[model samples]
Target chain A: MATLEIRDLHVSVDAENGPREILKGVDLTVKQGETHAIMGPNGSGKSTLAYSLAGHPKYTVTGGSVLLDGEDVLEMSVDERAKAGVFLAMQYPVEVPGVSVSNFLRTAATAVRGEAPKLRLWVKEVKEAMAALQMDPAFAERNVNEGFSGGEKKRHEILQLELLKPKIAILDETDSGLDVDALRIVSEGINRVRSTGEVGTLLVTHYTRILRYIQPDYVHVFAGGRIVESGGAELADKLENEGYEAYVKGGASE
Target chain B: MAEQNTTGSTTAGSIEVGTAGAGAQLAGPGTGRTTVHQPIDARVAVKPSFDVNDFPVPTGREEDWRFTPLHRLGGLHDGTAAAGERGEDKVGFTLPDGVTAETVGRDDARLGKAGTPVDRVAAQAFSGFEQALVVTVPKDAVLTEPVRIDVRGEGGVRFAHVVIDVKPFAEAVVVLNHEGTGTRAANVELLVGDGAKLTFVSVQDWDRDAVHAAQHSALVGRDASYKSVVVTFGGDLVRLHPRVSYAGPGGEAELFGLYFADAGQHLEHRLVIDHDTPHCRSNVAYKGALQGQDAHAVWVGDVLIRAAAVGTDTYELNRNLVLTDGARVDSIPNLEIETGEIVGAGHASATGRFDDEQLFYLQARGIPADEARRLVVRGFFAELLQQIGVAEVQDQLMEKIDAELEAAV
Candidate 1:
């Protein structure tokens, strides 16, 4: 089992004036087999936290530590973090032209697995995973996310999550653009990985609909660059009905 | 920065420039249009003259010679670089069934039937060559395999000429492979008979210090089709000029090129297609990647549609990917349309660095920066590699591309 710990994390991004702090003194702990739901309104630094833990170069870790099983993730490069079993399913997955989906996935798997997988077995694995997510096998030959629809992009993220089999995955708004059916399918994919009981998941979303399919062990209400409230699953139901009005007002600048 | 990926579409006049507009200038040439120092004058087209003195030496200021370093021509231009000193041309041919390969003297009637020398280098090649080789396919015959011509330079300065002729209704593919280069200047001619189809492939895989200059011309007959595939990978300096003209209506021509210019290598490809007849079509696509300091690539595509040409459709595209610093590309697309009653004409040229977002995306997937860099560059060239129909050629090109990328680090 693996554990990811973020201690007093402070992240900043370069703006017109200077480095503007986005994550201020945020602390979080995620253990393998545990689901942590970080729910927040727009511009509350929830995505920032996801990117920071994933070692995005744009998000500078000023005064914090991102540890994956006691190894300093901040000092590691982006790919290093991924090899260390930390995966980030970006809210906006990048489009890479000229790179076929099969090539990209195999390359990534080779890096993570330390050797190239057998071609026949690998092709079978991809076809099965894509079929599970309702993706056509043709997606393997197309360029990576080149002309995929939003729902296709979401499903592709889940496809990677299933294939990569990381120790922990941070899904940033995986349910944002998915329709009801796609959401259910993507949620099923997530639940399949969750049921494996060897991976931790941090689902960052604005709605509680996806939580119904993939239940979180703990829910953290994020506001003002920090988690202001935490509870066992019940907190999500409270936010679904009461909304973030009380938390936003409570954490507003005085 | 490379040209932003754009779907092919028919546009009105020629000369289309593409821009990434993503603000990621990876230090490529700023001028996105074709880079020809001057327009090719009307006098560039003429009958082949087998006299060295018929063509004057270039001052490197002419439109055709502007991008070429004249001092590096290995003496094929100014009469200073004599023949049979630096390299000797060793020619061999492997012909398929029902094809003929012949070595004829300069007076052979079949010589120079496809094209004439337009510049001093071509004229010098025509006059100075000790012997010329001609390959022909019989009428109403179709070949299953391609005819292979291996031109290997043993040593010394060599002047050479070659001709490929396909009779009426005959279809054939010809591959001209150059290796073990020296200082060499040569001229190649293609004659496609009525209702014939021909695919001519010229590969220049020269030595690191070799210098080569060649002019290629094709004459398309009525209802004939011509396809030219030019692949250049290794050379200190290599310049190839490919041109085409029509003899009858309903003819078609397609020109495709693939090049990889490494450190201190200069690869220049100049093409001209003259549509003097009606109902002719032409399409040109050339892709190149340059790496290392002082690695440069130049592409000049010129298409002319005469008033007599009524139903003409033509489009030219040149794309360059600059992989490392100190590498530059000059792309110039020129179209001179004398008639407005044509079907369509267009050209596109783009040169840029690798997309930063592409690299980041790959790296985020746990691919190391070096490996990711190699993958991105390979991806940039993958599309063109698929166009090479020969399995062996494609595999060799892939290995060469990988080796070049490995040295980039």
Candidate 2:
């Protein structure tokens, strides 16, 4: 079974003088066919976790290791990690103007599959995926994430997750800018793709609305670069009702 | 072959000069024309290395020479003298195996192409380097690695011309680099045979005080493809003219340019795609960024679908980003389609400042304002870089261009 393990992972950026630690000894384990939602407020290293896993150069991994199915993730390059069945649906997807979505998808899909997809079958698969997302076929011809609305960008990310079929998908605040209709469409797309029981997901978010669409097996509250609380699905409701002020102050005092 | 040398000095400067349009259509005797003349010893200017004929002068009437700077001929001279010896440090980039570079003067027997008349007046007046270096990629040759050619100009008036011949079924990437700290003008001719493909890159990183000028002429035959990418970041007055023609059916050509101009720099790019046959296609895209006082850049793209070029499909676009009040960019895209049976023909040109909406979007996403602008610029140029298709080279170029963008802002 596929798995994602982050053990004492630390990260930093290159500021003037020296590196500043961003991720401080954060540990987490996500198994295949499981949904784990990491809830956190703004500026609490949520996106940093996503970038550190994606091998963004600005975020240096000062210590700790990321493993996938017992293989060291830190040893792989960004593209290599991508090929190793690790996918990050960026909270703010990088807008690649002049690169068609279909073309970019095929390239990334080809990289994951270890070979170029057959032209005929690839077209059919992309069309079917677009239909499943209720997206116009012409969107594939448009540049990747270029001029896409807020909800469209999120849905596009889920569309990629569905088509690429990664072993462990990382959704970093994918629901932040989405509206109610967009959230439902995006979450429905995710649910349909994960229903096959072949993929696991780590859903990083702050809202519980998305969780209502796609249920999580485990809910973890992240504060001060570490998980402060872990519980079943009911934990998300409690946090939503009580707010994060108490936990944030309690963690800060420690 | 004999060496002739001449040394002369002339002083000419023009202030409050109007913008020189791409097609030289200003319509005045002194608008874009100037002449300079000074007397000096003849021995210092001559190049007698191999042998070449002096190119002829133009009356400012020829189609190819119409849009060029014509008034700089007052201080020009001709010579057959050998060039001054320079150490290896002056020249960079070792040639690949099986490739040969020979330095030949104007008097050489192979100076000009067969059946082409020599322009003696223009050759003597416009030549910058003393000798011409010719490189050849043999027939059926496939170079797994790129060939680097560095043309270094030490000082004084220098002119160099490079001739490249890619034989049939051959594939290669030829990087012609212009690097030096003096006045320079280099001309290059690329000839690709049937069923051959060539990715030619011209990187202009000349000294900031240098006046750089170049002309690239290429001919693509049946089933052949050619892609030229020009990146210019240095030089006081740099101008590149790329003239390409498709000689047979099913031929393709792409012209791409990226330029950044800062204070006191004037960079210009002129491209012409001549579709002489049916079923040929050509595309041109040139983008630039300009900042600071008197920073000016021009892009003129012309696609000509001749009468015989039925079924031809051509498109061209020129976009510029102006970053300062004193900076300016001029873009002109033209399409002249003679045949009505063509597949498609379109052209577009636009000039605008940074988009405030995009900046706000990125800033609202938690990116600092400055870094947000950087990301927007990266996102803007990423489309072009991705099309370059060479991962390592693209990454390296991206890092360098990113640094330039950061420094500019």
TM-scores of all predicted structures: 0.87, 0.56
Put down candidate 2 lDDT per residue, B1-409, tens digits, no spaces: 0111112201111111112111111111121323111111111132211123533344556543444444432222124312423222155665677767787775554333311111222243224345666777777788877778776767565566676777788887788777775655556767777888888888787777666666676778788888888888887777777767765799888888888889878888877676667998887877787889988887877666666777888777777778789987766565555567778776666777777654533332223456545655665666676766656657866786788878877
DockQ of 1: 0.65
TM-score of chain B of each: 0.87, 0.76
Docking class of 2: incorrect
User: Model 2 TM-score?
Assistant: 0.56
Query: In candidate 2, what are the lDDT values of residues A11-101, reduced to their tens digit?
Result: 8889798887767788899988999999887767777888788676678888999999999989976666777888888787756555578
Candidate 1 docking classification: medium
Model 2 ranges off by over 4 Å: A1-144, A147-152, A156-254, B1-89, B107-130
Q: After superposition, how far is residue A44 of candidate 2 from its true place, in Å?
A: 33
Tens digit per residue, CA lDDT, model 1, A1-254: 69999899999999999999888888889999999999988888999999888877788888978789999988998888888898889888888766789999999999988789899999899999999898988889988888889998989889999998999999999999888999999999999999999899999998999998889999998888888888999999999999988878865411
- Evaluated at residue A60, the lDDT of candidate 2 is 84
lDDT: worst 10-residue window of model 1 chain B: B20-29
The lDDT values for all models are 0.83, 0.69
Off by over 4 Å in 1: A207-209, A221-225, A231-254, B1-50, B83-86
Q: Residue-wise lDDT of candidate 1 within B1-409, one digit each (tens)?
A: 1112244422222432222111111111222323211113353532335577866678887767888988888778899776346456777888999999998887776776666666888788777887888898999989888899988887578888888989999999899999996888889989899999998889898888888889898989999999998989887999999989887999999999989998889999989887778999998999898889999899988887766778899988888888789997888777777767788887777887777777766777789988998898787767676665667666766787787778764
